[model samples]
Target: RSDPSSFCIISRLKIIKTDISLDGTKKVLFELEDGNRIESVLIPEKNHFTACISSQVGCAMGCKFCLTARQGFIRNLKSSEIINQVIQIRELLDQPEKLTNIVFMGMGEPLANFEAVKKAVNNIISPDALNFSRRRVTLSTCGLVPEIERLGKDLPINLAVSLNAGDDKTRNMLMPINKKYPLKKLIDTLKNFPLHKGRRITFEYILIRDINDRLSDATNLARLLKNIRAKINLIPFNRYDGSPFEEPDEKRILAFQDELIRKNYTVTIRKSKGADISAACGQLITGP
Candidate 1:
């Protein structure tokens, strides 16, 4: 019921849909009652119970490599829209149990719509309802520091920070939110997070060719993550329209990942999946 707040109700009710199968995981996209849309992913491993949910219609955090920003900010989804993404996908895909994992990594900056995101996650983990564990859910953000720290105190779910750059100058260019919060402030907030050192903090670094893939950047990133209990997921750049950025060649990417491992850092190179269907890393949809 949470439609784009600022838009007039004169907007037509149109629905656009898409489905993706990645690494044998099946997902269906749903355009809801509101002008916004959301997606649900059914991973075979989790009995197709995994659903990656979105908290907002369009993203306000305009990451340079993202396609969702083109549609701009619509509105924050209500608790129903967020929960329905799971229900609709199950009915369409015939895998209701497959809606297991709920990730706030889809269309918008989740923390920007924190209350809705919190309500949705609560429904997901509620004993009388969808009934998922906090460990099975993850929330992704573009380094919203104060919000990040707030989540540590409130939510028990896994957290992923879209850490595209190790330094401020590089990050500011890749993600404009950097100009406001900056890397140092982000790190300080992470360090002060209620989660202990042993618990993993996922740093999602999308490797753009010649941008964040160099050996020096990798080393510098490892240095920063050293103090925090971090697991870095190096995501290959997923291209979108107007983004001149290119995914780094595989060999170079492997080398850069190796450099981090050599530095005694826990790192993993996430294979680029669903790019062929335009549902990869930064290719999330905004609306109908």
Candidate 2:
């Protein structure tokens, strides 16, 4: 058991409640150290919905573009804590449709908290309990290769790698994790990934101002995906205080998208919303 003193900041933090306008969309904040909290989102999208889940209290990935990393690592969230987010989302959801998707796209790296994440995933995906479809669930990683290869065999959940920089030189400076698990090793791991038919690994590329946001970067990106079945998601950077990054201009972002389209790769540009409320993907940190 962890010392409560370690969780003092979190313990003092009240799970400030919020009621949604949509059909039964309600949530509460989960606190961690240093007044840190993670927001649970039960988005009532179309027919099937999704739960935005957190794996760690804070992140050590320290990506130049992410707000969570700026907060620093507190600790890995327990399996029950991870499971609680889903249980709460399920309770508040009063719609006719079920929660079909669960994303490890919140505060911390899911793989960094491997055992807990894996167990929680198994709990929900098991034949009993919530019985969530593994395909609909996605675990986002900063390209943790060993864990990635491990998960490939252990579970059937989808994998999304944060590959913001197309090449190593830029990637290493942008995402420190890339220095350890470079593109070649990451892709090779993915190339051999045991994804079932109809499932393609996702590559999430965030576009920063003039940095890793060029045409050649997109071209080089295409070369890197040579034989891998991957979907590229280009996210325009979302700015927050203490983050040393700028969102790429609209024209530049689209031009980069067009280049990837020219390469005949399945490409998507995700326009981020909820930044005003600090609720966008990778922006969740402990706050009011």
Candidate 3:
């Protein structure tokens, strides 16, 4: 017979609710034992689905455009708490096996919670555990230079930097982390990242209208990323309640991308999924 006491020890976090976007993306809210809440997103692509997991209950990075930053920092999630987001979403999926990718792009900067994130990532790709392939997992950071170096030394997984702005002035205004790491240091670190053959790092840029979508911005971004094997993902800003920024016009978005292409850089416009339910990029704040 099983011990009742063992069963009494419950998970630190529990699913509170899940909201589905018209586009079919799922945003699940999880409440911690102490009542703090965090969110995770599941986005479906053409061939497979990707689980966007969180590493912190809230974020301290304080990016002006990110909803999570407004919540302020709560605490780093334990490895189990982080992994549970993935496991729970997998269980919720009608076709769990279709989950082929994982991105640490949800609530917190994964590198900030290094040890716990590392542990969770190991189990995620471990043959004895989830057994996901190395290429299928990605960690996105808001340009934490030292931590980025440490991650390159240790885990060396696929990396994506949230390079939302092309210059220091705009970047500093948008992402406060830029004040510390800055663009030069962050780019230098990315240039040194140990990428496998033909694998490129991803640079995510959120195009906020009248903010960082100008052709000059694209030119500067191309120059900044020159010689670095990277593909830029242009995400038009997803507006939420009381947000100060507006989405760039579709024509401008394509123009910005075309400028980068002219500069010989590979770029793509990322479709903003789950925007209706407030689950798109930079919009993962806890809600009612």
Give the Cα lDDT of each candidate.
0.76, 0.79, 0.88
lDDT of 2 at 35: 53
Candidate with more favorable, higher TM-score: 1 or 3: 3
TM-score each candidate. 0.88, 0.88, 0.95
lDDT of 3 at 247: 93
Candidate 3, poorest ten consecutive residues by summed lDDT: 1-10
Candidate 3 lDDT over residue span 1-288, tens digit each: 122123322464688889998989999999987788899999989888999999998899999998999898889998888877877788777778888899999999899999999998987787667777879999999998988888888885799999998899999999989999889999988899989988999999999999999999998999999989999999999888888999999999999999999998889999789999989999998743
TM-score between candidate 1 and the true structure: 0.88
Question: In candidate 1, how many clashes are counted?
Answer: 7
Across 191-273, the per-residue lDDT of candidate 2 in tens digits comes to: 99997888898999999897899999999999999888889999988877777778888899999999999999999998654
Model 2 segments more than 4 A misplaced: 1-14, 19-28, 32-36
lDDT of 2: 0.79
